[model samples]
Target: MVHVGRPRERVGITRRSLFGGVAGVGATALLAACGTSTAPSAPSAGSRSADAGGGPSRVVALSTGHLDHCLALGIVPVGLAVAVSEATDSRGIPDYIKQAFGDRYDLDSIQVVGQRMSPDLEKVAGLKPDLILSNKRADKGLTEKLTGIARTVQTNGGSEQFKADLKIVAEAFGKAADGERLLADYEGRARAWGARRGTPGTFSLVRGKGDQYLYFGTRALASIVGTDAGLTRPAAQQFDEAASRTLSLEQVGLLDADWVFYSFPGNSGDFTEAPLWKKLPAVAEGRAFRVDVDPWFLNASTVAADRVLADMQRFMST
Candidate 1:
């Protein structure tokens, strides 16, 4: 079953405002918009089953969220779509995936499948993916349409769901052993991170763009980081109704916590220059950390979750 959400409203802003009044757009913004095309087109299709002996030969990754999981299990799809802007490193794709696979992975082989809110159905169809894997919440409609052209699987955005999806992808590619090992390794690392830092610290996850701020729910990176680091989440009415909730600049003061991890919309860092943002205690105290929305939060999958953990460790240690 394919699921769709309300389309995101595009807010027009002047170039000067986007770059924090800098002379040119930042590298983060350029990377974020990279390979992103508004045009829609049908994707190519082909298949290879894991148990059938050799595994899926012609694969297509519809969701960037799952790209790391696929790469960990030695499955490289013919197509991949991810928000590269939020990546910690400029490698664009996850480092482990790139190191293991090399430059043979071509961006042209991958198509821009649209952002978290809006998916380009035409582009997905044009890729003709053999097996489509994505978060159940984000790609419900696209999954259904892709199924007509190829097999499709859905995984929840949660950590447990991410592991399950990895296993399923591994089985599809006949790499169940590798998948198991990868899961074990990931769990081991998480446990180590937790053990070194015993009790977990409090954290608030927010995304800022200009004057607007969106608070991520427990299901987001804040929750993931909190859980992984053995920390507690602050009680703030738990806005579980939406994936994210918008907060005013004044309201941000209410989110007082040990650490703050935030992302910017469309890769613009203009919000950092806003006087109201600078007034936040977290910002004033140097506890505020900025993340790119695409790779950091929205593109989160099993693979990217590891990076999140690493970043959290760095942030917490400091």
Candidate 2:
């Protein structure tokens, strides 16, 4: 679950979820700065919303999928777990969210509870949200700990998890009707975009982590959304796993397809200097382009999916 911010073209940042720890505001600092609550922070997912009748509710989201689902549905979380992924910033609001829903809502001001992988439970306790949203990918004991403090519900994963998460969260806030509409709208938009793109072609998602590169499979967020938008993938890269495949620099040829999108851990640096990069057919044809990994790579939310589809639309139009 990753939330993505705005995209700055040509900026390279790896969106793969691999790291020792996430950087976040400490509990002590958050308490000193954001106030504390002696009471339980929130209710479990099955509980009803404490928000005003017919108005938006406050949510505490543990995963990027939860955060983006609520935000796309117009329910800004009171506090959200930030990620070290290139998709989000220090505040955890991805640049794409700012660009897509900036006028509909102001997520930038939302409080940061902790990092997604290693949330500062103390800081989340201080936020005092009425509800908490998490998913199954959390470490074994962590979800139970979250439920102890608040009403937490685990969202499922897979290609359709984005829609499923919205349904769960929308019903929590008495926005079930709206959630259905959002899903319909997404399906309609995806279908229309697919029709517009017309031609079928293979897409390759590449991640550069120093000398060894990783190729995304069917389960990666962006790849899932792209496939839904009628984009095909290289047969060799298609697999049921969500994890990526790491290959040495000499194996760059394996990532070739009709189109290839590359994301780097920070900046691509002078990657073109690598001998294998030029051998890829997409590079020679200029079909391989650099993209911001935040919104395009670890993508799992409706907002990021929209951004990805919009990008494909632009590319297809050309």
Candidate 3:
């Protein structure tokens, strides 16, 4: 169901069917904006190109994941769409990103075009950006609309394809070598960290939101990082076809592991307080810790991967 720019190629598989019947009950909509999208506005000459040599500079990030990729490649977007968590932030940038960029960039100045699901096309057009970085979340209709405003590039998958996504984003920005090097560096660091840890026991990743508990699978950012670090996943979380498996509080024991990392969009009480949750070995042993949803669940680039690795080290030690 995800399509991108022409010559009319299908860039991503449909995530709709991947989550079982969640799409029918509006849960998929909630997850759809895991990243954000841009809006439309009038295109101007200023938006055409930021350089005399036809290189893109005034880029508009249609998704936060793409935004992370841009930042990783040393590019600060002229504008970006934000996820719900990001929209709530006064600065419109995630805290991890703020700390990562530090004073090297002015985070507040980047215009927030709109939410991921509903980008303000007019605002995006108003920015007159030369490039638009998005994921497959930008449908054919949105892609056409975006192409009219600026050159648009979308990767094949969302967080599920972070490696390929980062490479695609880097290529679009004309930094293929840098992108490859970044990936290699991340792989090296992850392996080195794994080696230092010797044989850490299985790690479990869960997310609490509303009434449901999400068990991350192979496609999730944290899961991917765990694999890179040579960590093991509980059998329930070993699959790759879907991003995650939705579990009811009654099934909390399925998330049990030697170490458990859980995060929520806000407070963690929703699914964490259930009776089954307390019975989990990790929870009983005080090995479960709450984590931030931004880099762990939302952002899926090298920058976020690094944060996930650091978080793993910190949480495992505690």
Candidate 4:
């Protein structure tokens, strides 16, 4: 058996420690836009899987989210594509994936195909994959190129449609039963966690973006999880038209709520120097907590969703 190693430990930033003597604050990156696309073409007719006989054994995932979906469905891609903007140090794989699957799979053996948006086709082709997966809808040319290499499948990109996206992947690999079971299990966990809380107050979602702040809407991943747990959102964050809205320093009051779940990229630095940031009720009362960026803002896999739920349970109970 190929030995798997434990994931490297990551420290969650707290407002008090990371922001000096001032009030605490948490942050997150700008929201990624999900483009529109028609449903992906299904696998060959009469075939239950990506291949003719069984299912795809050799797969290539073109994004961290898709990679997580494959792993969640018991499919490990031989190749993976990551974006240059990925915050994890473990090549392009997110830290949450490492923590969740590190003990079960030899992640290091998986080859890096190329950047998430534009993979190195040569490397992908070399993998000899039976199937490829992606969620990007804006680039038809890239999809065409990948399809030429293997049986490529894609989802309508967005965090809000994460469950639907997972269904698409499961269908592509002939694991619809497993996919539905996974969703049911996840929803059960989220609902159970919420039931235990018994009215956890309005939770604010914030992230640091450059010099400003991002207030997440109902459509964001964390927000979705929060909804699953019966958590309330501040009035300003109730809109679902967009994933997030940019907030200048002067508008920091919009982030105030009963609690705050926030994250920022490692390079984005701390955003605690502003007076308005210090004035937020959650910050002053020490309700704001830093979270991992990969699961909070980037990947939308089931592992990421589980991590978000786990983080909520950990921080809210404190």
Candidate 5:
């Protein structure tokens, strides 16, 4: 059996990357946007089971979140999209993904089919995956092409649906019980964090650099997970439908909140020095906490979700 090898050994930034940090993940590049599209075309349906002489179920996962779900379920996919970003190292697996589920398994053995946004179709098809899993929604156009290659399943966004997606993947492998248990563990951690956190307070998750600032709302991982840990959302980010909001750096006042978790992405080394960035009450009050973009802004698995809670827990302590 192919297993994760030493190439994935824990280390500092392994290579310079062209991609932005997790928070800087281009939706058009990584996981699809959270809200559903009104007109999503249906994908062909089918699943392969390992019967008698048949080989084991071969799964190919696209996007970091889906890959997390599959790996956390203890099912190393035959092929997975590579993660390449300033937030992580060059290894197909990022440090945060490893931190979240490293104790459970090695990540090196998983085959790197290609980059996240547009994987090498030839390599993916060559794997002959019995099940092709992707959790992106914004680019459902790829659904037809993926389905043509193999049975494909995609999940919706929002924290609850993210957990549900993990269960769906588990069920696909007849490991429903395993999936539910993992979700339960995640909830337990969230609840424990909520109990110890100072008190319920408003917070905003900010991501961006230069002129393109954005806020993740109730549907994004950090916002949803922060709420799970007893934090409330700022009025501007509490919208019901969309998961995120884009704003010009000039409109920084809209980010008002008791506290804020911010990621500077590729520019963490040089936090924006704009006047608007300096004016936020949260920033002036010592309530602004800089966060790692990988786990805090990317990877939507139960493991990553728990890491979010942990980040809040650490933030509260400091």
Candidate 6:
């Protein structure tokens, strides 16, 4: 069961469950540094205004996952969707947000929205947001409709896009200085980690259930590690687009990496129990690792990225 510090909020009857039921397993011990026990802080109340710098008036975040970046730069939204579920265990949303706003804000306060699939347009329109912040994966039709009601800004959901997105959001809210500082700090940490590990090692990034898909050779975080962290991808799979391409379990052996840093459905049980996953060379040799999905890949927030780098350092050092 997912453990929450507080009670759940009521919203639409649908009541979507976050990553509940997923066993923390081998990765649990590694995530202690990344998980937040409290909500992150919101931007100062008077700091953000339509006339502050003549920016967009009403702001709505369709991508609730990236909320951490907005909050870090002091950009609060009229609406947000929560991703916490019973499976999350000890990791709550970032403590900065929860401590700042208390219970006044939660995922339900923001109009419920979805990505890739159709979101509740009527409900979103009712919220009457002035601007919408969404990821590239959001449904194109839904974004178009939302634009009719408010201005829309799209962010690429690549690995490095998280840092870039934070800067863009901060600039949109007149917090460019804050965004830059945060990025520099994160980049510095990443560089330090990279310098310590000499001689690149073979690596692969994977996700999903039953059929595992490998991620490599793209501009995302995986590529960042391979290029910046001194890691190398398998010679055969070293294509220009491997980072973005998804592969099947049968192809897992083709990766032939010295280490595998991948994501799994947080709801699944222990990795050792899964027969198909057990067959992986990385997993068998304890070279495979599971990362928190929200912060590592799905969510692109400033705080989340920092947590990701810390986690990566721990994994690499071990």
Quick one: ranking by lDDT, best first? 4, 3, 5, 2, 1, 6
- Each prediction's whole-model lDDT (CA): 0.54, 0.63, 0.68, 0.69, 0.64, 0.53
TM-score for every candidate vs. truth? 0.67, 0.77, 0.80, 0.81, 0.75, 0.66
Residue lDDT tens for model 2, 254-314: 8879888887765544566677888788888888766667667765766566566655554
Higher-TM-score candidate of 1 and 4: 4
**lDDT against true structure, model 6:** 0.53
The deviation in Å at residue 113 for candidate 4 is: 1.2
- Give Cα distance to truth, residue 257, candidate 6, Å: 2.4
| Model 4: per-residue Cα lDDT over 1-318, one tens digit each | 222221122222121111121112121210000012121221222211243448887788888888877766656677888865536775787666765666555678678878888899999888787888876663889888888999988887778888899999988988786677777766776787677677768988887765566888998888888888889899999999898899776787888898987776654445665777778888888888888777787767666776787677667777
Candidate 1 lDDT? 0.54
For 86-187, candidate 3 gives per-residue lDDT tens digits of 214854577767655534445565788887766899988887777888767667788888889988888875677889998898788666766787677667
Give the C-alpha lDDT of model 4.
Answer: 0.69
Over 130-232, each residue of candidate 5 has an lDDT whose tens digit, in order, gives 7888765636666777888888877764454787788777777666766776676556556665775557888888887444667777888887787776778
- List the lowest-lDDT window of 10 residues for candidate 4: 29-38
Prediction RMSDs, each to the true structure: 12.4, 12.5, 12.6, 10.4, 10.6, 8.6
**Residue 57 deviation, candidate 5, in Å?**
3.6
Best by lDDT: 4
Report the number of clashing residue pairs per model. Answer: 20, 12, 11, 7, 1, 25
